[model samples]
Target: MTATTTAANPDAPATAPRYEISVGGMTCAACAARVERRLNKLDGVSASVNYATERAQVSCGPDVDPRLLVEQVQRAGYQARRVDDVAGADGDDDSEQARRVTDLRRRLAVAAVLAVPLCDLSLALSLFPELRFPGWQWVCLVLAAPVVGWCALPFHRVALAGARHGRSSMDTLVSGGVLASSAWSLWVMVAGGTPAPGLGQGLSVVNGGGHALYLEVAAGVTTFVLAGRYFEARAKRSAGAAMRALLTLGAKDVEVVRADGTRRVPVTELLVGDVFLARPGEKIATDAVVVEGRSALDVSTLTGEPVPREVGVGDQAVGGAVNVGGWLRLRATRVGADTQLARMARLVRDAQQGKAAAQRLADRVAAVFVPAVLALAALTAAGWLLAGQPAGLALTATVAVLVVACPCALGLATPTAVLVGTGRGASLGVFIKGPAALEATRAVDTVVLDKTGTLTEGRMRLVDVRPASGQASAELLAMAGAVEAASEHPIAAAITAEAGAVPAVTEFEALPGLGARGLVDGRAVVVGREPLLAELGMAVPDELRAGRGELERAGATVVLVGWDGHARGLLAVADTVRTTSAAAVAALRGLGLHPMLVTGDNAGTAAAVAAEVGIDDVVAETLPADKVDVVRRLQRDGHRVAVVGDGVNDAAALAAADLGMAIGAGTDAAIEAADIVLAREDLLVVPDAVELARRTHRTIRGNLWWAFGYNVAALPLAMTGLLSPLVAGAAMSLSSVFVVSHSLRLRAFRPNR
Candidate 1:
């Protein structure tokens, strides 16, 4: 997460060092924002805090030790430590999330066990007077004690932490409500008076007036809040499970080749420049270029393409991809953190740890919400006291208002949705960078797709073949395929693939800068470009001239097939338009987004590909550097453009677009610059990601509405004495639960193919 830039001052030896730290006990977006605010207040420091991942990305000057960043976060009211400093025992189950889950379950079990019985007894006492007996209050208090005191430890501790930092959070509300109810019960037991076995049996007042104890309120609040926290933790873990699974895809070990001998070692032990051999079924150890052997790699693990990609000498292979066919000897170009797989994992992690604009606003509201609620509670108490209500009733109303006004819901609204949305998208092979990328998708009106790799297969394929007026089609392909079998070019491969089982030529001669000459069954066959056809003294036949011209106009590379020194027929080769690309373009149109083809190919090629894929606007003849200017021009024209591409040449354009979606198989530069990554080669993910963003934002808006609406409606009722303290406690705890539960619904999101 750290990137060092040279200091602007020429004389300065160094600049600020950036550090990322993980802070424990951040229950809401407000807590993360508060930590970020405190860290940024320090001299020469700036920070971005993400609650979904519970990590802070911080930058500070060299003069300030990185350790101080942790201290600052601690000052902002949470437990803190540097990410690199905290090393748990190495095991899959030893992750921070696993530990949190274990801890939450334990606390929730204890609270629920005690709370249930206590609530039952309190409710039983209210409804069935015969169940009341001597020492019943004592028994209820005994049961509620541990539930509020021990089982509720986390909330109390966090609330105190917020107090020290002069900020209040969800914990503050929960702790205040629990402590007030518990203290009121204890105070009633000590001072209010003792009741006989049959006392209050026939009393119509269930309120208990000033003498009522709320042992159930204290216990129930603890149990419900802890239960909510447990489920919230589990949902968060589920949301990030895909990313964790991705981290495990890289090879664990590889055979490192040496001058003396090859030695098997852990991938961590291997370094750049080391050569390694990958077996037929083994995963590629790192990002490397093949030095020997040919194989079809199942790179779908990285690119989400269903087809196996052929890789041979000098072709680069990504780590985590399995070599499905033949063995490959590769020279390690990138190892450890430098590998593509590692970079992608890092991107997902870093993207998860970013703050969205909506979350920032929610945090600001929460920072002020708790204090305002407390003030409102105090005003309500004074107003009631002035109106001649008893002190106990006033205190009850105050507690109700304090408990009902939930900042937790507001704080949980955005981060939880982001967590589930990004996680679900990752599962779908749509790597949404973060909330900002999601936000960009919702606004973008035009999508620009690159031709070579985006809308097309990026590989040559034989599209058509024509034989002279009366000649057999099979005979023409037989001779052409025989000549092409001697070549290693992509065009040759496409022709050979479509040639079927053709008879081998007797003698094949290679033609440089042209086609080849061969002999099939004692007949002279010339296969090459038009120049080679002319060199063979082959005259263009009148009947096939129009057909050849049509193929050439459609962006195909046409080769002249000649035999016996005369033109025979024409064969066309072009980059295959992906079978799914037309549907993807149509889907974008249905979404009311204009799809344009932006390619550096010749106008004929670009227009032909565009027509095939239903793209009306073709921006052809674009220079690599000028791609950015194209995106900028679209922006100036009031189009919110999202440009999709797959190479280093597209990096600038990706960065310049309103939203940049890079292909997963693209160069590192493009992926790094992109706001979103199409991890799957399917063009459909473009519209899928956009539709997913719209859905996620819609969910966020809905959650915020419920959160704000609940508080707005409930707070007044609580103040006006329409809602009781017991009801208020239940409402407060459930509000947070509702927000988190709503966020979990996104985990069920399944995008259309």
Candidate 2:
């Protein structure tokens, strides 16, 4: 048995462990792109930054220092620290995140409260003409002051930080818009006198000099932008909630047993090889093997299967499983980073760091977008001022340009869709590795499915039974089943299941990996494969071999049952094909995706299973490593391929495929390598994921076009002075709202077929 070991990765760094950094102060997708670019520029370092998660996963070489990562992030005007250290070092964890949300809510409330009265007063004075008061400008000024300066503090702070780092973001555009609009409004209030106001003037007050007072514009923009951020923060938090829940599932404390006495210790203090007592309804402290008792363990938290796994002495039990049966004593075999739960968390982190092709383009464009918009706004103002336009008119156009061109939509176009899509996938039992997983799935023209544990239940069972003509099948099975019952091998258990009750057998003997030899009811009986039959001196009749040739060709593990040294019957054992495998294959084909079987099993076995599952393409008798080569060959043929498997041996192939989908019930290594993990072990989810990906990919593109189209049409209108700052501000807010709303459509997704 090639027992899977996961702690020591063949691809691990020699001296430095990978660090997942909790990045602070990223305001947009462009900010994440910049941080990733800066970190990657360092020698012997690679980084993937996700703005939605506010996390950076970094890999460093022995030649480089890990501290350099923190320093580089700091220089880029963001904070970074190891994920495990971030929450405790600053005395902030979930509370810090909650506090940020609270801050946005409070600021939004303040801006809303102050802006409402200011707008109401301005409207009343403009329409009635008799509501004028002494220094009403001062009252308007006082109300607009904190709404712009204090309520919009987050924008100004991030904008200034970006400026310090020689960059700009959506925040810069927003801050500039508010400042330009507010500054000009103050100028008119102090230098120009307000004549009587009238109706149908919108939010602007036109005085004797034709100068405009935009107190409402200043307050409204701040309120709208603040509302967008508050909702955006809430959505981002929702996308990451699953990972946080997974991290918290570990048992906080464990009961340790020793020669001195039984005592409880924190789970972190438990060591490898320690003996621990797990009573009924308690979670296993760490990965261990039951040594003294039997119980059924519920492994659903990790595998997503509700079935409880029965364990006896020497059966390995994984961490995070709840003991559902009687008390059991287990010896810890793996702990801390070695546990399966930690590995899944690490894989989730790594997957979140990757950027999809569309996302990369979006981020790169956003990096250049902010600066270009600033220049355009300046040029819009300069062109007006140079053309003999009044300063008030020029500034109005400039502020309008800035407000209209804010890339809130651009920054949100990809990540919002990705966040929503991935969250929906998790609920449907499909965990996507990252945005790229969906992109890859959209292009999957061929699906390479592993035989064992993927299309079949990776366990041997009785598949075919034949006896000599006129011989009683029950009588033949009775003698063979009795002799095999004394053995505990997979093939024996399968045969015994189909075999009816039989009298007791004596003189039982076992042959490892071959067959069995014994006496059943005082009659000599034997059961084994072809080689074993020959070894047992049993003469296989030519008629029997010829008649059974088709069964062997169809992938059954043919075994000869003999008595008195002559073949009497044949029994075939095989890994049973899943009931839904055929339907999944048909669905994939209907979707225009070619389904192929790739397996390490013998050609006969592979072909038989393929035929049963409605698959025509078959690659058989390949070694584990050769599986990767097969996937690469398919890719070289210009095929976008997805490999589905559920074992350690399939890990390499799964990773090498364009999209690697692991059955959630698979080994940890396989799950870690897969780009998509199916929590329910149902092959049908493969097609569901494919459909979901295609849908999400379409949604992202449509959103990008909407965002790009809105800015393209709005910027020119604002620059030409046809659009007011108030109108531009409303359009900008709506653009972001539209992107988020479109992305949310994915949340309602379900398996269509």
Candidate with top TM-score is 1
Q: What TM-score, over all chains together, does every model reach?
A: 0.80, 0.79
Model 2 stretches astray by more than 4 angstroms: 1-18, 84-93, 162-166, 195-209, 273-277, 288-318, 322-333, 427-429, 461-555, 558-573, 602-608, 616-639, 648-656, 667-673, 744-748
Model 1 misplaced regions, further than 4 Å: 1-16, 85-94, 164-167, 194-208, 292-301, 306-315, 323-326, 460-554, 557-573, 624-630
Clash total of candidate 1 = 0
Question: Which digits, one per residue and each the tens of the lDDT, describe model 2 over residues 601-720?
Answer: 557888889999999999976666788898999999999999998876688888899999998767777887888888666688788878877888888898889978898898888888
lDDT agreement of model 1 with the native? 0.77
RMSD of each: 8.9, 7.6
List, residue by residue over 513-585, the lDDT tens digit for candidate 1.
3667888778888887666688678997876778767876878767778998788898888988888899999
lDDT scores in order:
0.77, 0.76
